[model samples]
Target: MPEEMKTLVVTGLRTQFNTAKGPVAAVRDVNLKVARGEIVGLVGESGSGKSVTGLSIMGLIDAPGEITAGAILLNGEDLRKASPKRLRELRGDRIAMIFQDPMMTLNPVLRIDTQMIEAIRVHDHKVGRQEARERCRDALGLVGIPSPEERLEAYPHEFSGGMRQRVAIAIAMLNRPDIIIADEPTTALDVTIQSQILAQMQKLCRDTGTALIWITHDLTVVAGLTDRVYVMYAGDVVEEAPVEDLLDRPIHPYTDGLIRSIPSHNAPGQPLNQIPGITPALDRMPAGCRFHPRCPRRTDACLEEIALRSFGPAREARCIHPLVEG
Candidate 1:
């Protein structure tokens, strides 16, 4: 991809947290590229560093945790090297993040319109209050909220869970940012609401040409929502491929296990499939392949250090014993 089309490029990212025992590496050697109007899925289990990657990109890692290495480039500007003040300026204007919990984005005491208008004026002081309110109404409508004008006047407590999530999404879209990192924004909603939000998000990206990195552990969610998929395990990305290709012909053992575990893939009465063994603790992680202990295809060669090797077009996997050969 040309550098001009790439809105967000992350390379060799390593984020660690300083603990009483020592530094725990929560993210390692992570590389991602997102182009305008593209939706990329960052998939993994609960502790797969998916959220950390999103936070790292947004420069949200707090004191105990620090980004130790690598570059985060936004339209060719290195964000990792940017000052705190610059980061704050860019956050709601050029880049935005939608957290899992709607409460994270909404203030209970404030009216929806007030909060959204404040968000807009904070970054672009030139926007008049009435103009910002109009933008907020449009955003709410775009997310499929009903009677956006009245909804805007309501407080955060007035809406249901799904409606609150939609309002949160509306706030994220208020600025028309170049990049949006959504950390499982629809995870808490029902399946039907989740589907609706996913469709709206894709449409918003298409209409506005915003690049989105969707962070989620549910493979089913990304199977249809994302264009490309990256699978992470034990702080490392284990596989990268186009969404269809990855779901249809997964190369890494870990990727295959994730697909197999999806409930729809099994018979109704059969015990749901599951990946064996829990992810290893960061400090006590296995020396070689972090997934070897749980991988059914592991061999002696897997005991050696592995690197992400390229396969067929736009595919890569970090494994010595991939389930499929390119």
Candidate 2:
């Protein structure tokens, strides 16, 4: 793919926050790229900085949390240097984010239609209210909402949790943004609902050629949904490859441990293969590789900082002695 065709590219991205203890590295230097019509998954456990990386790309990190270094290029535009006003202009129109909580995007007291039309008008004032309403209704139906016209007339509280999330997703798709960073949007839904939403999202990306970044800790979700997966540990991308490659032949020890730890990998009577030790706290990340303390395959070389290097064609890992040697 040509450079100009890339939808999103993040290089040396680092995010940190100020706390009473000290500056905590929430997201260490990381890099990835997504092309038009591609689906990428940022897979990691909680506090592994999956969401923070998404927020950094969206320019949503606030207050003490800031992007200390790196470049976030959306469609070849450097967002790191974009003005606040320019960022606002790009938001919702060229780039949109679907938050984990639906309420964060929806107003409690406002009617759904009121909010949806307002969202459209914010970027396109020339769109008449009635025209915008039709677009909103179309978007809601696209997400499988029943009687979208009537649903639009009701308040957010009137909808169930699954339905509310669907609405949130519809809002993200309203403008057909170039890229969407979904922060575990389906994590709250039941498996059935999650599958349906995932299918819809996949179809949306295909039909519109819009790139997508699905951030979640659930390997199961990434297994079937994503084309490529990036496994993060201690705020850094420890492994990245095609989804099947990462799952069937994980290069990094942490990635191998995560795949082995999945419930489906265990037999009925067998105990799960959980990775030992908790993820190190941000403020107390171990020297060298952040995951070295918890890594079962640790070696003397692992105690020093390592950079992501090629493990094979189209695959990379941060460990000095990765399981899948070249």
Candidate 3:
């Protein structure tokens, strides 16, 4: 895709947290791009730095956790160099984030309408209160909320967990942002609710031409939802390809393990397949390839530092001995 088509682009991103020992990197050398109306999956196991990457792009990393190095471009705007005031102004207006917990987006005391309307008008003061309320209603309706006008009057607590998440999605869409980074937004919902939300998100993106970066550990979700996938291990993105290509022929050992671990891939009554070892702690991360310790394909060659190697267009794996050929 051309540069103009990309709504968000992140390059050489390194986010670190100041720990008791020293500064430990949570996200390292991450590069991602999401074009208009595209859904890209950032997939990995827990503690893989997916959330930190999302936070870094949104300029939400606070004290003790700073973006040490990166160029976060939103429609060509350099977010890393942007001032705090500019970031605040851009957050909800041009880019938004849907967190796993709806509470992160909602205020307990406020009614849904109040929150959603405020979310809109805060970015666009020129919009009338009535217009904002109408937009909120439409946004709620867009996300499949029933009786949106009446539902808007209810507090966050009045809605069920799924409903609250829907409201959160509604709020994120209020301003029709160019990009929305969803950090496991449906992880807490039931399987059925999760599917529903995923479908809704797809339709919303298609309708509004809004790009989305869905940060999740679920390969199942990625198979069904994303156009392309980036597989992360520890803090590094080990693989990147179109969703089908990655799932069908993963290059990195870690990416292959993740795909095999999906329940549907195993026969009935068989032991659930899983990656051999636990993710390394940030401070205690292994030298060279972070996943070498647990990798079935590990060799002495893996002990040496390896960088992401390109196979073909949009295909990359950070491994010396990849599982498949170009």
Candidate 4:
């Protein structure tokens, strides 16, 4: 929470999609901060706009989805106003991203060595070919890839699913960037591989002092891997708090419902709690509080627009009838 320790600051991010029906606000009024060497988990369901928020920060959104309003600041520099050339220069060198699919970051036709060495060359052209190749091998080994030297000669298709993911992650960490945005990088892997990758990522972040934004729908993964957590609902951050505080005592109804829905939290033989109803369509968003319809504690007060209110030190929630008693 200290000002000096903060590495990335994002505020008032609004991203909308232009569709035939009209403009759909996929992300709205979202604000979050990641401290140096800290990992923050952005958790929500499939259509909660978590991925859109990450893409917006990375400046990867295309014509249909545009970031309309917001400031994305990386180490005090405003990324929103940066020119295309500036963004390109800063992207892979200072800020790297590990996408959900390895293919997004890897080219099937190119050998691993070519892609990785090119990445290093782009940032440090003075480094010789031999040194760059050595760095590429080191990067591969850092991600737990075995026989990295020989593997470098193989194409992406030759590696297994988990191996491909490891290669992609290695590429992201090659530059030792200040921040890494990982969007469900482990969602498709088996549990053992997931655990290994998560541990490696955590160790890398701690050792290299890299800030990380891990976007995922799995609360279980977030509980173990993140220093802090932010719950997104209907394109807005409904709650934000330290990991322990949010898990132990969530302040918002939406947060409570998500925690309750986790199978591990239910009593043996008891029916699992499920939040009914789907996320509201962005174009047809509700007039008042976006969550009012499904909230068990909803009342007439919920019929008015609500903004996030401070709950305690470093904790905030947006709800007319908060689940937690003050």
Whose lDDT is greatest here?
A: 1
Model 1 worst lDDT window (10 residues): 1-10
For residues 89-179, write the lDDT of model 1, one tens digit per residue: 9998899999999999999999998899999999988999999899999999999999999988999999999999899888888889999
Candidate order by lDDT, highest to lowest? Answer: 1, 3, 4, 2
Clash list (residue pairs), candidate 1: none
* Cα misplacement distance, residue 253 of candidate 1 (Å): 0.2
lDDT, candidates in the order shown: 0.92, 0.91, 0.91, 0.91
Give the per-residue Cα lDDT of candidate 4 at 32: 90
**TM per candidate:** 0.97, 0.98, 0.98, 0.97
Off by over 4 Å in 1: none
lDDT (Cα, tens digit) per residue for candidate 4, span 208-287: 99999999999999999999999999898999999999999999989999999988899988999999888887777887
TM-score of 1: 0.97
Better of 1 and 2 by lDDT: 1
Query: Model 1 scores what on Cα lDDT?
Result: 0.92
Where is the poorest 10-residue window by lDDT in model 2? 1-10
